[model samples]
Target: MDWITHDEDVWFDFRGSSPEQLTPGRFYKGTVDGFADFGVFVDLAPGVTGLLHRSELDRRLESLDWESGDTVFVQVKNVRSNGNIDLGWSIRQSESEFRGAHVHDPDGDEDGERIEADDGGPEPVRKTPKGISTESRATNGTESGDELSADATAEQKRVEAEHDETRESEAETVEPAETVSAEPDVVEATTSDESAGVEQSAESHEAEGTPERAAAEDADEGTEAEETAERTEGPAAEPERVTVESLGDRTGDRVRIEGEVVGARQTGGPTIFEVRDETAVVDCAAFVEAGVRAYPEIGEGDVVRLDGEVELRRGELQIETEELTELVDEAADAVEQRLVDALSAKARPETVEPLADHDAVAAVTEQITDAAEAIRAAVLQSRPIVVRHAATADGYVAGAAIERAVLPLIRDEHSRADAEYHFFTRRPLDDPVYGMDAATNDVTRMLQDNERHDEKLPLVVLVGVGGTTDSLDGLGLLGVYDASRVVVDADAVDTEVVEEASVLVSPSLTDTGAADLSTGALGANLAAAVNADVTDDLSHLPAVSYWEDTPEAYRDIAGGVGYDERRTRELREAIALEAYYQSYQDKRELITDLLFEDGGGLAGHVSQQFRKKLDDEVATAKANVEARTVDDVDVAVLDADSYSHRFDFPPTSLLADTLSRRDDSAVTVVYATDELFVRTDADIDVRAVAGAASEAVPEGGVTAVGVRQNRIEFLSGARETVVDAVVDAVVAQI
Candidate 1:
């Protein structure tokens, strides 16, 4: 057998090139091919395989949880002439646990072999195959044979014999000295073991990679020629292929990406397409010409290949597209399948057990899951979450719960400290039913943000509101721009509203008259599902929403978590006062502190003010409220224009609430000379009341308005007649 010696530098340069060239004393990331009685078979690469013997393992072989396709780290021990590979054990079971662990490939990227050893010193000597030994001088002036193992010598001789036969067979074509251009400095070793013991056949693998690599090289050469003709510098080296999420490290570097177009829009100078691969979504901008479409045919859900440079624009990562092409046939199907596999890993939660104690909540658990997914997806896509809720204590608590959960996620996912303020916003509405006025304000602000700052359209979330068909016009307006909407409410939602919203969480949709559940309860559970980290912080909000007669389950849950009935009431009172003061402002930080922070000082002080103002309003309303029995139904009617505060702190609706609570009336309706607002526990259609009043008093100018708000209007001259007619009409309906 022929023996050859190489310097340490030459050995360091060699790595896994071919089956016979697989070097020992090197580390590799391999795939578990199969398990045998003696050891596990590891496939290092297409033509390189090794056996990880059971005896070398630190633990019992049976204890390993590795499956066939699982990735592992192994050290090459020896290579036998029969093409049998021996692998040593590794203390590290995961790739992340090791430093400088790389894909050991001799013909891979140029920088692939530059991995640094942990100790900055020479590694222990390992036996090499025959004609590939490294001779090192003994520092102690003595030679020792301990470095060579018995099996290694025998294996080396067998490899030499196999090599001699291979050389004889290829004598007709191979020269005495042959080299591989891909690895120019490396020596080529001929082996006759066509049916090698590797996990994959070498002949078949070479057949597969040959044509693809040839075509790629030709295309690259053509591109280089074109680039050389145009400029001194040849074509920029083909960009590295990467997923969208990996773009963070590749900023300012060119990259090639493939993904489906989840969203697309036109700006003044560029066309932006939101490309979402399985990993993440990134916006790609293509500027073909000013105000001109870059790719006129590409639309949402179409798979496309993109070549671009990653750039940070306004604190967000975007791709500057240089080349774009739509994928078709097999390529399209493959891309689609990859996305489906990723989406499958994000399946809907199996159950909402802890949050679904009540039957009503249990019924709408599926809808709750959908809502949570939408909220989380918005955060992931870097879209701001805009919350709209009524300016009521209950509405405020619900909105605050979502805010608490979302702000933490924004902070954790984004680097900027002010991302919370920029990405999450809560706005108070005048009342339930996201009306035209509130929607118009949102649309105007979002459009301004998108135009001035190039911001993506915000995800509009409606809490304690937007559950009825009365809000359709406003929702449809948002839908026109393709802005996603998620509605969470405890009110009885109409069927059409449920269908229109991207996600609707309302127990009443499952069963009629199941509207006793509070919005805070629904939002709290949803908040927990949206970000599990904030679940404990939001558990008490549901109890705090109930002014009185809180559910036993929710009350216990709150008390067990430290918020008692008194504390809950204090929070409710504080939110109510805060909700009324500006009526328009959301008061995000103040509400967050009063609910989540220690010390009851803020809540106690606010509750005292709440009590005094509410008491004074109730006493005056009770003294002036005119009560009379009409057709066996006790009716309490108040002329709000004459006695109660209309434009002051206590709104007409709150006044009506106080009047109904103080009096023993079965029905209470408050109105001005022209407007009517009704609040009652009895089953009555206030819209029907307005209609009947218009028919009964035809001469009086009467109109039914704000069905969701239970409001109606009439002429001033017919005030007394209209009030009497409304009382008669309501009494008859009841």
Candidate 2:
């Protein structure tokens, strides 16, 4: 079969040339020397290389399939005076794609003779062959218009005479039409006749000695070349159809891919469409113009067949789209069904088993299964996951456990290198409540992403939070946007919380022993349930959450995993300290290292800070404690606002717990200006006490913010009255 080739241009072979020999706007054959984040380095000759910048590539830099020593074609875009070379990507990669090929020369264009196609296609422009030197052309007055030395003229004539005899002898045996019909090398041979014809015409012009006549003839030839190029230019050949998973092997080659457009983002230079097929998701970048959207008629959720060149940019695979056509009816149905089948097979875990044998974990096994499946499905569907956990040691461990499990899935499922960061996010909540402030911020960011980038609404997950009455308004706000919500906590949640969340995993619903469960224990088990591949990594996490009375099973698991009592305590203390300083940031890497890696090297240093800070705060509080008795119960009261650092480490709740552990009192009451924390050995209901306090001081606006922590907030003006009411209520209940 006859392949269509470029009519007027010739690809330059730079095997023997230097950098200064390269001509701008001309394509050259080069070897791939290496790769960089910005672009590929191509060597045209020994020590002669140029940078094919990412900006010049049709696709991402990382997507390129070119390896070292592999041949590639690039156009010399510019050669700086400072000896820096800037290369541009060439659409045609092979020498066969060009009508003719030439060996580059520094002095002038040493063109290769062009062969005329006998199939009635446009004839390529004729030029001198490599065998004829520039000195020969100077003797004929065609170059430099200077006369050569007697010896040099005689040498040129003898070489021309020998070349003519060889050309004539070859012409009699090999017909030009037959040569052109054969292989590429035979086609090059056919150019000899044309090369001779051009030489004869040059000599005829020299005999006339009419410079005006030669200039007019050159202009006529230039016009004819333009017409030939216009006639030859048409639609490119159809590219091979391939899958998204196969793009890694087909980089720098044009191909067609069919998939559903899951997301679309408009950048400063191109519109990137994240297309998902049965195998995986790949980003296709289409450019109409700078900052303008491409294929505006096609959007997210549309089934499309796009033709583009696969490219690697910044270590990510991306398609530089040529034509994107939306598939319809039967065509769309076929692709959709294929994707649906794949999603069904890959989105759900085969089975979910609890990490440990505990009644609290067993009580919520089904809920954990559902939550894990939901998370997995979200990843397969390309929906972002937003995990909001309480900003505490247990909360960070809980969030980090899920992060560790989900990130590998994201990397495996998505073709983009940065999918892990883009698909999953862990944000820490200031308190163990997904309140309106947090919900409002989440809504604002998600809405902006959806509006600006056409991104899918994210799955909002609440860990160690959102299992209380205080989070109802926040959960409700997310529900209004139709965002999926999952709540996981160890604390006993309000009954209303169960109805508000999409999925609730709390042992408190079915087991009275839920109070012994820490959010970290639930989180680690849930993470294992989400991705069982990471079960071994989560073995020690449950032990890290419990400060005083860790369960024997979890403690054994920690020891088995090489985390002894000291190491476990160090990790716990380190995470708690780090969690306080940047309560809102996930600090995923630092926390991961402390919890799962570093072998106690990092944890040792940070835990020291934690112990020092807490010990100092506890020492200060012990000096100011006021000992009293209420209803035959020993009580110790400390004005936390006066005794503790309000905005510093060892928060009021932690301080109160520490003091209660050290005191002989039956109840410890740490009262701040507007809030109070109650710690007791008695089985008194904290929420009931908060209710009684609110009733006794009806005008104080007293409320229970965290029943699990026995935390209450009241009007600052009624602090004195609210404290007495709370203490009396606690004593009465005991």
Which candidate's lDDT is highest? 2
Task: Write down the TM-score of every candidate.
Answer: 0.61, 0.65
Model 1, runs deviating above 4 Å: 1-241, 244-255, 260-276, 281-351, 354-356, 699-709, 715-717
Per-residue lDDT of 1-734 in model 2, one digit per residue for the tens? 64454523666766443556677888877766444333455667654667676567774343455655567788988775534467889876665666666666555455443344223222232343212223323445333334655554453345346434532110011111111111111011122322211100000001011122222223234344445655797545566667676666666887777789887765423457878877667777664322245678889999988777776644456676666788889878988998888776776677777777778998888889889888988988878999999888888889999998999988866656678888899999877888899999999999998887677899998998899888999999999999999999898788999888998898888845597899999999999988899999999899999988999889998899898899889998999899888788888888878887786779999999999999999999999999989989999999989998999998888889889999999999999999999999788778799889888999988899866678899999999999999999999998
Give me the displacement of residue 271 in model 1, in angstroms.
Answer: 14
Q: Please provide, for model 1 over 1-734, each residue's C-alpha lDDT reduced to its tens digit, 9 standing for 90 to 100.
A: 42332321222323454556666776666666444323455667643556675556674443455655566667777766646566788766543344443334556675344444444222222332111112211123333434444444353345335434542110011111121112112112222332111111111111011122222223234343445655876545556557665666666787777778866765323467878776667777664322245678887768988777776543456776766778889878978887766654443444454443666777777888888777876776568899998888889888998898889877765655688999899999876778788889989999998877667799999997798777888899899889999999887677888667988888876763455578888788878777777788988888988866677888988888889889999999888888888889978778878999947999999989988888887787778888889877788888888886777757787777767777889888888758777767777787778788888888788776556557777888888888888888778877
Runs of candidate 2 with Cα error greater than 4 angstroms are 1-259, 265-272, 282-293, 304-341, 414-418, 511-513
Where does candidate 1 have its weakest 10-residue lDDT segment? Answer: 200-209
